[model samples]
Target: MFTRFRLASTLAEFLGTAALVLIALVLSEITPVSYFVATSLAITLAAIVFIFGPISGAHFNPAITFGMWTARRIGTLRATAYVAAQMLGGLGAWQLYQYLNDKAVPAQSVTFNTTIWLAEAVGAFVLALGITAAISRAVDSLQWAVTAGATYFVGIMIASTASAGYLNPAVAVGLRSWNAAYVLGPLVGALVAVNLYHLLFSPSAVPVKRKR
Candidate 1:
């Protein structure tokens, strides 16, 4: 059994992630939304922040979780729980996608070229930086929104290749049941991104007391 905060946070992560995947999947399926994919993800992330940021920080992405943990912003126990919840949420999203669509949704082919990997790394680092800065209050609320918008633009643009720009492993898991190939490289890429961000930006590559 989990504590109240942990339970609530897990549920929030699950629902929020599910909604994000659903919206992205639905939108991408209808029209050629690949162009606007960045905007769509940004909107989803913003809404998640509005809804669950106060609760669980709306991680939804394992890379972010891992990065934060590595940066010493989160405790070991809490980080473990967050990672588990994120994985479950991603699996749930995939299942729900199947249930709603009445078929395994065809996943887009995402590949890994050096350029693509670099793009993913950069995207992940930028997104993580934005998130960390926001959490640390280094950036104001308005700055958070601006950061989200810019991060999404950069992220989508970077990952707009055969690989659907997976900057997080949780996202890869969500898409894995549909397309497994998109999982591996992006996970590595995202981890690299987070490590780079920590090395460059964090005071120490260790956890500190989180603001919230």
Candidate 2:
């Protein structure tokens, strides 16, 4: 895992993340499916995890990459490379989305307020928590899928009145939007999650493998 994958895991991360943002961009705007943002994300993300979870850990979000790095499950350089790949993937999706739609994607910054900030923070925190737990233990991939999907669902529902449910900074780039709430909330949440897990659940410094 020393940037020495002959298969080039960074490329894999690029492709995997591009696919995820593409699914969200295209599917979430198409009427019936658009109404079910959580459903679309859950299904697409579950499939992605099944396929790329082993390859690049399917970390399509910077927050997830940051969480893994904080937990020492990945080296700093690998994590940085993965994050770059994710941002590129997001950018690609946003470009394609704009081209296909023939219109500018809406700017989606959240209104700043304590309540809104907390909403975004809590949503991101829950997602980071589930992702960290899934990686930490011998949980089923299917279960991981459900837990992650549900976390998104719950988070979105809770923050419905506030943030745009960006939950990920990389995904924000893919969607062609940036909000301080979206960025800071997820970063804080993911950082807390990795540290909290080690402090309370597993104090051992041993890193979890990517495939798990």
Could you give candidate 1's per-residue lDDT for residues 1-212 as a string of tens digits? Answer: 57898889878877877777666666656756556777777887777776677788757777777777776767888888887877787778878888988988665554445665555666666676667656655445556656655675677666665446656666766766334334444455445655665676555554687897
TM-score, one value per model:
0.77, 0.83
Question: How many clashing residue pairs are found in candidate 1?
Answer: 8
lDDT of 2 by residue, 1-212 (tens): 45468247788788878888887677557743323876677677777766666667666778878977987888888888988888898889888889988987776654556665677677778777777777676467777777677776766666555666667887767776656677777788778886787768762555567884
Instruction: Give the Å shift of residue 143 in candidate 1.
Output: 4.4
lDDT, residue 120, candidate 2: 69
List per-prediction Cα lDDT, in the order shown.
Answer: 0.67, 0.73
Task: Report model 1's TM-score to 2 decimal places.
Answer: 0.77
Model 2's TM-score against the true structure: 0.83
Best by TM-score: 2
Query: In angstroms, how far off is 187's CA in candidate 1?
Result: 4.9
- Candidate with top lDDT is 2
